[model samples]
Target chain A: MSSFEAGAAGFVLGAACGAAGAAALALANRRRLGRFLSFAAHEINTPLTAVNMTILNFISGALGPVEKTQEPWLKMLREQAERLALIVGDLRDFIHLRLRDGLSMHSESVDLTPVLEAAVESVSWGFSQAGVAVRTRVDAGLPKVLADADRLQRVFVDILYHCRKFRDSGGIDVAAEAGLDGRIRVAFAYAGVKSSARESALALDLYYPARVRKDQLLTATGLGLGVLRLFLREQGGDLSVSNQPDGRSVITADLSAAGGGR
Target chain B: MAAKILIVDDEPAIAENLQAILSAKGYETSCAFDGSEAVAKARHEKPDLILLDVMLPKMDGFDVCRLLKSDPHGAKLKILMTTGLDRMGDVEKAFQCGASDYLIKPFGSVKLLQKVEKLLSGA
Candidate 1:
C-alpha cells in the first residue's frame, strides 16, 4: 500500500473516533442534567409540603384557637401555597415529559369511577370560583380499565383544571362509558364555544395556548395536552380532540379495558 | 395509654413537624431521620404506627417496609408510607411492601390524622 493511503486511512479513523467520543459525552451530560433536575424538583416539593402542612395546622386550629379576624390572611396564604404546589407539579411533569422521555407508570386493573370522582372533587373549588358548572357521569358498572390509577387521576385533574379556565363557556360535561371495542372512553365536552380545526390542533400542541377566537383566550397549563397524549400513548391508550358544528369542543381519552374485554 | 406513633423522614423539619402534630393530638410520637434508623426504631420502639417516608439516605422506605414486614412481629406493625412524588409505581411498591396506607406529601393534618386514626382502629 502507498504511504499516502495509510495516513489517510488513519486520519479517517481518528476523526470517527473523536466524533463518537463527543457524542457519548453529550449523552452523558444530558442524563446528568435530567437526574439533577429530578432531584431538585423533589427537594423543592418536600419543604413546600412541610410549609403547607404547617399552614393547614394553623388554619384548622390544630395548633391553637383561630381568631375570626385572622381568617382572611390565613385564607390568602393557603391559596398561595396551593398555587405554588401546582406550579411545582407542572415543573416536575415538564421535566419528566421533556427531559426523561416520559413519566414512569405502573398499570393495573383500575376502576375509574372513584378516580373520576376524586379528580372532580379535587378541582371542584376552581369550578365554583369561576361560576362554571361541571357535571360528571360514570356509567354504572363500567368495565375496569388497564391503567395506572394515579396517572389517570392526574390526567383527569389536568384536563378539568384547564377546562375550568374556559369560564366564558357555558359549562363542561364529563362522561365515561365502556365502548364495544374494548375501550373505556371518557369525554370532556366544553359547551358554548365554537372550536375550529386549527384551534383543536393548537390545544394538543406541545406549548401553544388554546385560542378559539381573538376575544377568547384560554390560560395555558404547563402540563399541556401533548404531554397527556404522550402519557396515554405510552400505556397503550389514546387521546383525541374534536370539534362539533353545534359549538362544542370535545376532548376524549380512551383506555384499554382490563384483559381487553375478552 | 396513648397509641405510640413513629415518624420517619430524612428531612428534619418534616419529621419534627409530624411529631409535633401527632403529639398535639394526644398520641405519643417519636422521630427517626433515615431508613436504617426507622427500621431499628420500629423494632425497638414497637410503635402502633410508623409514618415512613419513601426517600431516605441508607435505605428507601420500600425496602425498610419489606424488611420489617418480613419479621413475625413487624408484620403486625402498621406502616403508612409518605412521599413527595405522586408516581404510580411508588404507590404500588408501598402497598406491595405491606404499607397500611399511602399519603402524598404536603398533606393536611386533617387527612393525616384521619388515616392514622383509621389504621390504629383497624377499620
Candidate 2:
C-alpha cells in the first residue's frame, strides 16, 4: 500500500478514538451532574425543613407567645419560606425530568376529593395573599380515577399556582366531574391577564418567553406548567388551556377513571 | 398517658424543633440521632410512633425500619418515614419497607400534627 494511504488511515483511526473518548467523558459528567443535583436538593431541603418547622412553632405559639405585631412578620416569613421551598423543589424536579426518561408513578384508584382538597390547601395561602379565592367542587361520590395520588396533587398545585399568577383579585373555580368520554375532567376557570397568542402558547413551554411584560409573566421560574404537563401526559392524561371570549381563561385536565371508567 | 413518639434525625436542630412541636401538642417525645440509635431506642422505648428520617450516619432509615419491622415486638410500631429526598422511588421504598406513612421534608406543622394524630388514633 502507498504511504499516503497508510497515513490517511492512521489519521481516521486517531479521530475515531478522540471522538469516542469525548463522548465517554460527557456521559460521565452528565452522571456526575445528576448526582450533584440530587445531593444539592437533599441538603437544601433539610435546612429548609428545619426552618419551616421553627416558623410553625413560633406561629402556633408552641415556642412562646407571639405578639400581635410580630404575627404579621411571622406570617410573611412563613410565606417566604414556603415559596423558597417550592422553588427548590421545582428546580430539582426540572432537572430530574430532564435527566431521566420520566418520573416513576404508581397508578391506582385515587379519590379525587382528597387530592383536590389537598392541592387547594397547598396553594390556598398564596391565593389568599393575592386576594384570590379558590373554590373547589368535587361532585358528591365522584368516581375514583386511575392516577398517582402525589403526582395528581402536584398537577393541581401547579395549576392553582398558575392561576394565582394570572389572576390577582378574581376568583378561580375548580370543578371535577366524570366526563362523558369515560374520563375525569378537572377545570380551572378564572379571569386571566391579557396576553398575546404567542405568549399564551409559550407559557407552557420549558421557559416562559422573556419578551412578555413583567406583569404578564406566568411564573417566576416557569417550571411548573412544563413539569406538570409532562407528569399528566405520563399518567395517560392530558392538560389544555383555552382563552374564553370574555377575557377569562380555562385550564382543563383529563384523567382516565379507575376500573376503566366504572 | 400521652402517646410517645421517637424522632430520629441526624440534624440536631430538626430533631429539637420536632420535639418542641410534639411536646407542645401534649405528646411525649425522644430523639435518636442515627439509624442504629433509632433502632435501639425504638426497641427499648417501644414508642407508639417513630418519626424516622431516611438519611442517617450509621445505617440508613430504611434498613433500621426493615430491621425493627422484622421483629415481632416491633411489627405494630407505626413508623412515619421522613426524608429530604423528593424522589417518588424513595417514597415507594419506604412503604415497601413497612413505613406507616411518609412525609417529605419541609412539610408544615399542621401536616405533621395531623399525620401523628391520625396514626396514633388509628392505632
Chain A TM-score for each of the predictions:
0.84, 0.81
Residue pairs clashing in model 1 are none
- Return the TM-score for candidate 2, rounded to 2 decimals: 0.81
Off by over 4 Å in 2: A1-21, A139-142, A209-224, A260-262, B1-5, B24-29, B39-49, B69-78, B98-122
Task: Give per-residue CA lDDT, model 2, range A195-219, as digits (tens).
Answer: 6666566666655533356555465
Model 2 pairs in collision: none
**Scored by CA lDDT, what does every candidate get?**
0.80, 0.80
DockQ for the candidates, in order:
0.54, 0.51
Worst 10 residues of 2 chain A by lDDT: A215-224
Residues A50-140 of candidate 1: C-alpha lDDT, one tens digit per residue: 8887878888887788899987677667766765776577567667767765667677899999989987876666566667778999888
Candidate 2 yields a Cα-based lDDT of 0.80
Model 1 agreement with the true structure over B6-111: per-residue lDDT tens digits: 9999988888778878999899999998899998989899999999999899999999999999988977899999987445468778998899999988777889
Give me the displacement of residue A4 in model 2, in angstroms. 6.7
